[model samples]
Target: MRRMRVAAAMSVAALALAGCGSSTESTPGAGGASSSAKALKIGMAYDVGGRGDQSFNDAAAAGLDKAKKDLGVETKEATAVNGEPESAREERLQQLIDAGYKDVVAVGFAYAPSVKKVAAANPDAKISLIDSTDATGPNIVNLTFAEQQGSFLVGAAAALKSKTANIGFIGGVNTDLIKKFEAGYTAGAKAVKPAIKIQVKYLTQPPDFSGFGDPAKGKTAAEGMYQQGADVIYAAAGGSGGGLFTAATAAKKMAIGVDSDQALTAPPAARPYVITSMLKKVDVATFDFIKSLTEGKFVAGTKIYDLKANGVGYSTTGGQMDDIKAKLDAYKQQIIDGKIVVPAKP
Candidate 1:
C-alpha cells in the first residue's frame, strides 16, 4: 500500500510537471482532525518558480497539506507569476494578509523582505518564512536549514559516482544561501576524493535573483560544464535545475538534485541520469511550524533544521543511489555523530 501511494504521488507529480495537470492545492480540513479547539488559518506565498518546480515550493505545499489535516487549518496560497520581480511578491503577501489569514508562510528566501514588511504591519498576525533569516519582526518565525550537511553527503556521492574526476555545480544565485550548498558540496567531494576537480557556475551575479527560475540559462551553463568533461553536475538552482537535468540527460551524465527527492521530479528522459539528491526537509519544517502554531507554542525567532535533527540529508531512492545506500547511510551516521563537519561557505 505504501508503494502504491508513492507510485500514485509520482504519477500526479509527473502530470503536473508535464503541464497536463494543475498544481495541487491543499484542501482545508484535509488533515484527519484538529487537535486544537480553534481552527487555524494558514497562507503560503511561493517564490518565482511557483509550486511545480518539484523542489522547495512543492515541499512547502506538502507541509501546508499536513497542517490542514492535522491542525484543521484553512489554507490559502499565492504563486509568483513568471517574470515577476521580487517587489511583486509584496503585493501578493499583503493580499493574503488583507484577506484575514493569520498565519502566513513564505516559501523562499526572496520572500524575506516582503514577510518582514507584512509581519511588521500586522503585528497581531503570525508569520513564517523558510530559507531566510532576514525577517526579525516579533510576529515572524524564520525557518532555516543547515544545507551544508546534506550537500556534503551528495557531494561525496557525486565523487564516488563520477567516471571522470571532474564535478560541476550550478546555482540559482550567488547568495549566502546558495553558497552554503556549493561550499559544502565542494568540501565533501574533496574530503572523499582529494584530487577531484570542481567547476562552479552561478546563474546570476550580484543583484539579480531572476536566475533562480530560468531553466534555459541553467541548461546552457550545464552544457559548458559537460563540454569541460564534468561527469556529474549538482544543481541548486530551483526551476533552473530542470535545465541542468535536461543537459545531463542529453550528455548521458549524472545530475544531483536539491530540496526534495528529485529522482521523482526528473522527466522520464532524465530519470536515469540523476545520481542522487541533497534534500532539505522543507515539508517537515512547514508541518512542524503549523503544529507549533496550533498548539499555541509558536515562537518568534530563528528555527534551524540540521543533520542531527534529520532536517537535511541526501536521497535514498532508486537508481545509482541504491547501489551506494550502505556507504551513504554510514556517512550520514558519521555526520550526525559529529565525526564530519561540512563547510557552509566557499
Candidate 2:
C-alpha cells in the first residue's frame, strides 16, 4: 500500500511537470457563455464527512456556497459514505452527468479514478478534480495544493507552544498525500527543537479510509498521545479532527487542525483548545474552477496552489497564534522564495 501511494504521488508530480503547471490555461468553455448569460448547473461530489466536517469538506462547501451566491450558479450535492467503493464514486458522478449537470466538481484524491472514467464516458461534460492529479483529459481541471508547506507552519506552531516539548501527529489514512502533512509537521517541529519528542499515528491503512470520518478513532489516538506526554497534537484527519479537539479539551492540551480554521469552525467547546489550523484553501480552488467555467475559460490541467499563491497557510484565528504570527510569516516567505523545501513524504 505504501509503495502504491508513493508511486501515485510521483505520478502526480510527473504529470504536473508534463502539463507545464498550467495554472490558467483556458480551454474551450463547456457552455461558452458568461455566468449571467446562463446559470451553470454544477454537481458537487463531496468526500467523507460532506459539508459539515468543519475541516476539509467544509472548505470545499464554502467554495460551492460562494460560487452559488456570487456567480448565480445552480448546484446539487452528493456525499460519500464511510466505506463506499470506487464503483460507487463512479456511479455517483455518472448520475450527476446523466441528470444534465454538465459541470461536476469532485472533492478529493479518492475521486480520481471515478473522475477519469466518467470524464471519458461523457466527452461533453467538464469535470474539476480537487486534491489529485491521477486523472487527466481535455475536459478535466486538476486542483492540487502544496499541503506540506502549510502543515510545516502549524507544526512549527505546535513545537513553539508545547509545554512538554513533546507533540503528536494524527493522520486520517496512511496514504502518500497525508504523509505530506506528517513530513512537513515533523520537519518544522524538529527545526524548532531538535530534541523535541514527536509521536505519530494513522487511524487506518489503505482500502479502509473510514479514518477520514471516524471521530472515535481520532479521540482514541489523541488520548494515547497525550498520555505519552504530548502536549500539542496536529491532526490531518478530516472529520476525525473533531475527536482530537475533544481530547485536547479533556486533557487540557492543545490541538492543531487542518484544511480549515477549526478554531473558528469547530464546535464552541472545542474552540479554546484549537490553537491553529493548516489552511489548505480548497475553497479558493473550488471557487476559481467554477468561475473559470462560468466565464467561458474552463482550463484542463494541474493548478498547484502553494504558499506563494496564498493557496495554503496557517490561520491565526482566536488570537492564540498572535505572538508567533510574524515568525510564521517569515518562514512562509522563505518557503515562497525557495529557501525551504518541504518534503511531500515521511
Cα lDDT tens digits, model 1, 129-216, are 8988988878888899999988988998998888888999999888988999999999888987999999999999757776777889
lDDT (10s digit) by residue, model 2, range 37-116: 46889999998778887778888999999999998898889998877878999999999988768799999988999999
C-alpha displacement of 340 in model 2, angstroms? 0.3
| lDDT of the candidates, in the order given | 0.86, 0.91
**Model 2 — which ten-residue stretch has the worst lDDT?**
24-33
Model 2, C-alpha of 236: deviation from truth (Å): 0.9
The alpha-carbon lDDT assigned to residue 116 of candidate 2 equals 94
- After the best TM-score superposition of candidate 2, give how far the Cα of residue 125 lies from its true spot, in angstroms: 1.5
lDDT of 2 at 122: 94
Candidate 1 Cα outliers beyond 4 Å, as residue runs:
1-38, 80-91
Against the true structure, whose TM-score is highest?
Answer: 2
TM-score of each: 0.83, 0.86
